[model samples]
Target: MAFFQLWNSDHGHVLEACKDSLKKLQLDYLDLYLVHFPVATKHTGVGTTSSAVDDEGVLEIDTTISLEATWHDMEDLVSKGLARSIGISNYDIFLTRDCLAYSKIKPAVNQIETHPYFQRESLVKFCKKHGVSVTAHTPLGGSAANTEWFGSVSCLDDDVLKGLAAKYKKTPAQIALRWGIQRDTVVIPKSSKVERLKENFEVSDFELTKEDMELIKGMDRKYRTNQPANFWGVDLYA
Candidate 1:
């Protein structure tokens, strides 16, 4: 998979950025390509993410290039065979609905921050209803790294997941992943260690009961673990 970042959201830079990604990845085609965020930022250059910021350090959003226009270019990628599938990321339900309305090729997926603490059930249900798959990016509540970056505690530490883990003889992370999978959402948990990678992959063996799924569902505090406002100086989600 590859992502179209803020700097490459412009109509002219989109194709070049994708080609550049293919060259760097040494691949003939990408299985999936996604717009990293809903909003566009100043075009720094192809293969560059150094989007310009205002004096107050807010990301200089490019209002001239709308997401509808960007989606048209993304659709072109599918037609050109550069990508087998193209999607969006970090989009709320309203933006997602807009994309569905105006898109020639419907978005295949919406990658978003979701976990026990931030289940986002409505968004998940809506996307699935529209034939758009949901990919959970921070499936394990972002772990310790998210705690530092977003100041939100990891959902792995929650009593619900830990209790369920003990019952199933699995790690809290595995329980969380199972919950996401049970909900029909694809999970991408970040891990660097070999043991952790193995642990994360070992979730398919167990399935959460209907009641247990409800327990985790009730654990939702509606808290988002990945907040760009810390660096972007704008609350896009707000």
Candidate 2:
């Protein structure tokens, strides 16, 4: 399935941006289209992700357009057959609840940063309870690249995960992915290497035990790996 995310700067041009993406992909419709973030930023241009920043280098958030209005345009995408499914990303429970209340088409998915280290139990429960599927974006806690790019530690390095890996004869990454799958959240772990891709896919061969799942549950440090604050100059999570 072809999935694409509309950048925050493209909120105002949702229609145009989606059309641009479809055109670039040469597809009549997208399988899934997501609002990259709940917040809106100054419109740079269609198909552009560069955000407008203020004098202090903070992102220039566009407060003029409400998320409700943006979501309305998103709903229009479905009506026009531009996208088959619509969803949100990086949204917390409060924003998601608000969206569910106001949205004509309930969001099919809420993609969030979730892993053993940052198990957002309440948010996951809320979305699933309301019939919206949760997609774990950083399902394996962003792996080592997170540490290199965001200076955040990977959950794969945790001793618990490592120990579990030894017991399951799986890699630490696979153990983490298994934990996410058992939670009923769709896990999308990223890796470019062919071996790593194969390793990531091998999780389906083994099932994490109930006790093992509980052990991983206890690994939650409430730590979010992907921190955009260093670059955005603002903490959206805060």
Candidate 3:
């Protein structure tokens, strides 16, 4: 289990957060710990984390904190036996490259938004080349989330995905997840209902053909439903 920080972590806050997590989970150690996002925010205090924004409602980010420094602190968590492995989330190719070049303890994984709609082939290949595992978040293409946040389309209802699903005797979602697995990333799909959970989990039994895989891959419109830049009022990707 990975303990994600409520606030952007500094050296002191990193240890503090880990201890707090252990106490909450009643676990002495964790198999994996992760920095949830590449960005960090202002530290309110221990036991409380708030996203402090300015008068304009733009987030007041902690410009003082650095990724490499925070990662070093995370590496110490392993030394202290708080976590066995550490990884990062929402990092791009350049940021990942920097971490690979600078760190003594390399990131074990890079969790990012990946689906049939937004393949991000270069970044995925870059991480894989450097021995970093890729974990796909929002793997099924969050239709509800997309409608809520960006008012954009979702891959859940995509024609190609649906067609493949029908051909394979599976759900549209199953086709999306199978496509993700075939792309060589770990897909973390979510569901509120028990049936959906079972549906999402039982994807390994079926396999999409090479032609089907390419068909799904070709559906990439570079359409990003989750846009942190628009949400945060900062273009993190740019």
Candidate 4:
């Protein structure tokens, strides 16, 4: 549902990406389509998405493309019936505000990294207040990415999460995800294990008490586990 090349928003490949995804997915139309990131980069190859980088490995960015222009194309996709809904990802309030200001078809969702560690309450509040639904992408705090990529701490292992898990009789991950859902955000937790997947689905059965919510809220480290700067050389979140 997300295009990889929102970096070069000015090059105008929204239709091509949508069609390519449809063909690959074997679908006639997508339920929702989203711009993966706000930054636009020049295409590295035709019919392929490549992140063009300089010798220093900094991502090549194009400033000529306006988000409004690209968003208009997104609106076109909705009008053309290629996608039922259109949204943005990794956008904070300022960029989201800009999209809302210029958009004829307002964004329905904003997907961002949200978990106990980096709650991003202000941004979530802003989006919800303006009718933008939030989708939480690293609802468990990017444990895999943290361990494999950054060698950083995972929110799932936090003492607070452990305490809550013990209190709720749930896994730490379940508690973290439950907290996010209770915050009125949709959580898309990534897991390959069948049992783990089932466990994630089971969070809807229990509601965290207000006292427990406050306890988990106090665990915010403002820590982001997926810092791609190590490889991309540019911190996209930065």
Candidate 5:
């Protein structure tokens, strides 16, 4: 499991807390350590029910702690052997570019909400150009926990998705995951169910054809299922 840092008054303290937690967990090293959001907010620990919100009830952006500073700390973690690699989560192209400019140790990966419904091709291309691996969270279009976002808009229920699924003899979720992997992005679909876990990993066996891929690509709704409203004041994409 990955550990996300909490938003605190002091970013340094947050990094230290993460290191301490790693020691308590007895993890020799973390495969990847990520900045949970672009801005710091209240943290209720891993798997907590609290949402990322601000004083105005808008989703907050975390650009206050400069990307350069965060990247530097991440580099330190890698150099000190606490983490094998460092990366960012929920960063857009502009923020990513800033990190690239300032980072001595380029990010190993960028984890984001990517799926058939929101195939972030441009951001994916930018990451690749800079030699950063892209990891997709919500590869199956998110989880049941964020049902308002993922469940309300059912990509699986689309006729086109269903048709392709039938033609390929695969589930819509599998097809979605396959699309991501085929594009050379690592997909991490969240599911506690044993069967779903097994199903998500089974995407490697089949390949979606050009026609099938085109059809899926055409399904892009540009849906951003996870943007925090508090980011309105921050120029996250700038």
Candidate 6:
């Protein structure tokens, strides 16, 4: 599972809490641990609050803590046998480059919002160049938590996606997910619905054609459903 919002002040506490949770849950250890954001924020239970915003509205930025410090703490977790591997989530290319420059242990994965509309080719390429795996969150477009952006994007409702879905005998969401897999990225489409969960995992059996992939790629409108830019000026990645 991914671990986010860890830092020096509470890094040890967070690590211990995770260990206890894993023990209680009867899991041997997490396959991967991720710093959810580059910055720190007020924690409310298991979630965090942010003041980040963009042209659309307010959003949370990364924490004020340095990324290197966070990485150090993460590496400590590995050394102490708390996590098998550590990585980052929602990090931009610039911050990722900084991490690469100073990190003792390079991130094994970089999880970000990736879909046909916002494929993030440059960032993906940067991570690949540094031997970091790219994992796509919201691979089937944005989640229901932020329907405004997702609702505005016509790709989800486009006749092209619809026609392609018909051709592949799959849902539009499934087709979108297949695109990510074909691009060689791990896709995580969150849904508590059991049927949808099964459907999301079932894409492994079929394949999208080269023409199909190109058609989907050409549909990019640079639409990002999640943008917590309010903390842009902060030294979260330092």
Q: Evaluated with TM-score, which candidate comes out highest?
A: 2
Instruction: Tell me how many residue pairs clash in candidate 6.
Output: 10
Among the numbered candidates, top lDDT falls to 2
- Per-residue lDDT tens digits of candidate 2, residues 9-60? 9888899999999999999999999999988999888988787889998999
Ranking by lDDT: 2, 1, 4, 3, 6, 5
Which residue segments of model 3 deviate by more than 4 Å? 1-6, 9-12, 47-49
Q: Is candidate 1 or candidate 5 better by lDDT?
A: 1
Query: Per-model C-alpha lDDT, please?
Result: 0.87, 0.93, 0.81, 0.84, 0.73, 0.73
Candidate 3 local accuracy as lDDT?
0.81
Query: Which pairs clash in model 5?
Result: 38-62, 39-62, 58-230, 59-229, 59-230
lDDT of 4 by residue, 1-238 (tens): 5333233433467788777777877888888888878877776543465577889998777777778888998899889988889889889889999999999999999999889989999999999999999999889988876678887778898898998899889999999999999999999998889998999999988999999999888888888777767766788776
**Ranked candidates, highest TM-score first:** 2, 1, 3, 4, 5, 6
Per-candidate clash tally: 0, 0, 0, 5, 5, 10
For model 3, give the 10-residue run with minimal summed lDDT: 3-12
Cα TM-score of candidate 4: 0.93
lDDT of 2 at 76: 99
**Candidate 1 overall lDDT versus native:** 0.87
TM-score of 3: 0.93
Off by over 4 Å in 2: none
What is the C-alpha lDDT profile of model 5 across 1-238, one tens digit per residue?
A: 6555434323445457556658767787787777665655444453333555557655443455665676787788888887877788788898889888888888888888888888899999999998999999878666455556433365666788788789888888888888888888998888889998898888777899988889888989987665444343443433
* Candidate 6 lDDT tens digits, 1-238: 6443343233324566456546656776676778776665433333223343456553333356556776887788788877788888888998899988888989999999889888888998899888999999778777455466334353567676788999989988889888899898999888889998998888877999999999998888778766544234434433
Off by over 4 Å in 1: 1-12
Provide the lowest-lDDT 10-residue window in model 2. 44-53
lDDT of 4: 0.84
